[model samples]
Target: MEDNYLTMDLLRFTTAGSVDDGKSTLIGRLLYDSKSIFEDQMEAIEKASKQKGEENVNLALLTDGLRAEREQGITIDVAYRYFATPKRKFIIADTPGHIEYTRNMVTGASTANLAIILVDARNGIVEQTRRHSFIASLLGIDHIVYCVNKMDLVNYSQQTFSSIKEELKTFSSKLRTKDISFIPISALKGDNVVNRGKNMEWYEGSTLLHTLENIHIASDRNLIDCRFPVQYVIRPQNDKFHDYRGYAGRIEGGVFKKGDQVMVLPSGFSSKIKSIDTFNGEIEEAYSPMSVALTLEDDIDISRGDMIVRKNNSPSPEQNIDVMLCWLSTTPLQPGGKYAIKHTSKDARCMIKNILYKVDINTLHRIEEDKKIEANDIARVSLRITQPLFIDSYSSNKATGSIIIIDEATNNTVGAGMII
Candidate 1:
């Protein structure tokens, strides 16, 4: 049972929607209906719900952990929850809905494989819905499941759900994501979320949990271009293992096998994989998101920030790159300011070469005249790095194509960028 649990694949998903769109309630329903909540947790939420003068148990209290969030009945920060079913494991990032907290949504959704966007059946499509959808596409999330929630309030009308679905279809046609789906649900009444509620016999589709368990995510990884950035060099000097030299890191792309011909970046030295080592022993092969130490046949000069790739399929070394940057700091981005840059395992200094344009996320238009980038602003900018980086386009491989900017004085991450 333990082995089966460990081997079960995980799916990380984020929930986004307008205020009161039932993002938290939907996740809480999943946890409660799946029997993931403990007795003590259920008791606590039940007590709190009574104190708040609710008629019934408030399931949203399961995720709204902060005191401010509970007091205000709003999610102020990103609340993460974990649960599992027999088929798969799950991580849920319940992000804030306010436009001011858009950066929180980006932080939570950066590594997600899918996004669950809620839409209130009564209100239909709105601004926040479009904003979150655009950001999900920008982050390259492949699958989007829009839950048309609160069907009970709308009398579970098929026409209401159909109208919202049509509007979403028309708006999402402009999005880059291809695999989009819709499900009518009543999170408060426990309908069409975990079980196929009888109230929705008119609708024919899998439940949200069923969709999450069976979605095809294995093909989403970049398997053609091999990218392995060296995070650390392991050298254990002892009598039993005196000659142990291994380059350790997480594989960013493609599959690496024993005896595969690999090239070290920057130095351009060539070698073959001697072994792939893990705590469980040597593995025959490794792929993206797997952490392992690799022993090479040749004793090349390799260190952190160096990347190992297939000789025939290597990322180009770049010094000047264009990126879509999301500014996260309070201080506005300076035109020619210099900042520390961290990309994959490589660290370097970069300067803002130019600001091409800012994006009005709601309208999805390029604002060429508004060049000043403030907090929560997304813009296209050019950066000149001190060292050449091995990079692929963000659309091609997210692992090798994202960067973070740190403020030199405070040592805080101020911005995130996606390579164009």
Candidate 2:
């Protein structure tokens, strides 16, 4: 089983590819090969396989659970599956591959640490490949695993793999990608996915499982910028601790320690960290992703949505900001529409100030003529918020650097923006 139950470790991974590139199959194979599936689940797939008259069991059947999905043999929604090996526990987001479902890919990849871009060996690279990589980079995902799937169909040729690798290198160079690695594997024949394949003797790298288990993801967060937006206030009215007041929140950035000075955002009032409180008792320091109730030396009327950050390295407070937005609504984005702007935990009413230009993601050219940006389209736009937002560049900090737009009428997320 995954060490999560034992150690509370979790890895969130998302799969991306063109339709029929075998993203679902790859996830099923990983789960099956890792012995993460239960016997009852295996039996059900085996029975389903016999009914379908397939030569071999469709491993993808394990995850394609919807009746409409199984009938059509297509992944429509973002199917989240959880499985674990002794070394690690994984939450896999099997994202839809259709171009129309670009929003689904964005939703799945929002919290992912690594993205597995599956590419068919026969097709090589395509526009969807570029789009997927662009979205990964935009979302601040550091690691990219280019799994060249269906290697058995290519006769396990190194030439084909090398050609794809070179093309990926050339294409990825134009993108703002940080870490990229290529691996050849046949998800169908199970080569180099969980075990080394004898057919591909020239390749020398650990299997995909090894890569997932050992990737250096510990230092991915920006440790220099300390951002703690209080989510809730804990006050227990008991006899023992009647006067206890704590600020409950998740650490969004850098290390926080006792006696370190922190400034509440927009207020500019400085205070010292009295102590860091956790269920396990008091701690001296904390970092990003850790949930703790912080006790400050002074009670400065702090509440939810209020940010506690380092006084020296604070973000610029501004109302007007430039952003790269990926439209997610069917209604085309109007240049001057009012919407609910959510930055970190703080909410504000914002009006679209200007529409700069929409970029053709397939070709990376700005389409000046196309002013109307529809669903799945990326564009550069400016916003004028009613309240000032404290943020850093999206390229530097994902937490403080990103915002999601929700429509006032329907209350749906209409777009995602990256602060520039």
Candidate 3:
């Protein structure tokens, strides 16, 4: 049972929508119906609900743990929750919906495999819906489930659901995400959330829980381009292991096997994988997201920030690159400003060579006239790095294609960028 639990695949997903679209409530419903909540948690929620003068338990309380959020009845910061069913484990990032909290949503959804965008049935497709959907696409979330929430308010009307679904389809057609789905649900009334309630008999879609448990995410990882960025160097000089030299890191893409021909970047040294050692023991093979120490056949000087890739298939070395940058700082982005850049395991300095254009996320248009980038603003910009980086396009490999810019004086992460 322990082994089964350890081996079970985990899914990371984020919930996004406008204010009061029921993102938190939907997550609460999942945790409750799945029996993942403890008795103490339930009792606390019940007590809090009573204090708030609610007739029924406020499911949103399960995730809205902040005092300010609870007092104001709005989620300001990202709230993360964990739960598991027999089918799979889940990490839920309940992100804020306000436009000011756009950076919070980006931070929560950065590492997610899927996104659930809640749409109020009464309003149909709104501005926030389009904003969240576009951000999800920008973050390379291939799977998107647009939950048509608050179905009970619309009397669970099939016509309303159909119309909203059509509108969503038309809007999402412009997005790069290929896999899109729609589900009608009422987080408050628990209709078609965990169980298919009788309120929507005309709807023949799977419940939200069922869809989450069975979404096809196995092929979502990049398996063709092999990339392993060395994070640390392990060398035990003890009596038994006097000559041990290993490069320890997490694989970013593709599969690596013993005896595979690999090359170290920057230095461009060639070596074969001698062994792949994990915490358990030596493994014959390792793949993306796996942390392992790799021993090379030859003695080579490799250290942190060096990438090991298939000898024939390697990321191109780039010194200047174009990126879609999301400015996360209060100070507006300054053209020709130099900042510290961190990408994968590598670190370097980068300068803002040019500010190409700012994106009007709601309209999906490029605003070339406006060069000033403020907080929560997404823009296309050119960067000139101090060192050549082994990189792939963000669309191809997320792990190796994303970068963060840190303010030199403040040492704060000011921007997040995706390689174009």
Cα lDDT, all candidates: 0.91, 0.87, 0.92
> Which residue segments of model 1 deviate by more than 4 Å?
1-3, 69-76
Per-residue C-alpha lDDT of model 1 across residues 222-339, encoded as one tens digit per residue:
9888999999999988888699899999999999999999999989999999999998999999998899999999989899999999999999999999999999888899889999
Off by over 4 Å in 3: 1-3, 69-76
Clashing pairs in 2: none
Instruction: Give the TM-score (vs. native) of candidate 2.
Output: 0.95
Output the better candidate (2/3) by TM-score.
3
What's the CA error at residue 97 for candidate 2, in Å? 0.9
| Total backbone collisions for each predicted model | 0, 0, 0
Give per-residue lDDT, candidate 3, residue 227. Answer: 96
Better of 1 and 2 by lDDT: 1
Candidate 1 clash pair list: none
Model 1 Cα RMSD, 1 decimal:
2.0
Q: Taking the tens digit of each residue's C-alpha lDDT, what string does model 2 give over 1-420?
A: 543567646788889998898887888899889988899999999999899999888888888766484546442367788987776788988788776667778778888999999999999998889888888877778889999999999999999999999999999987776789999999887898888879899999878988988887878878989999888999998998787889999999999998999998878888999989999999999999899988888878887878899988988898999999989888998789999999988889899999999987777789989799898888899999998898889888888899999999999889999899
lDDT score, candidate 3, position 415: 93
lDDT of 2: 0.87
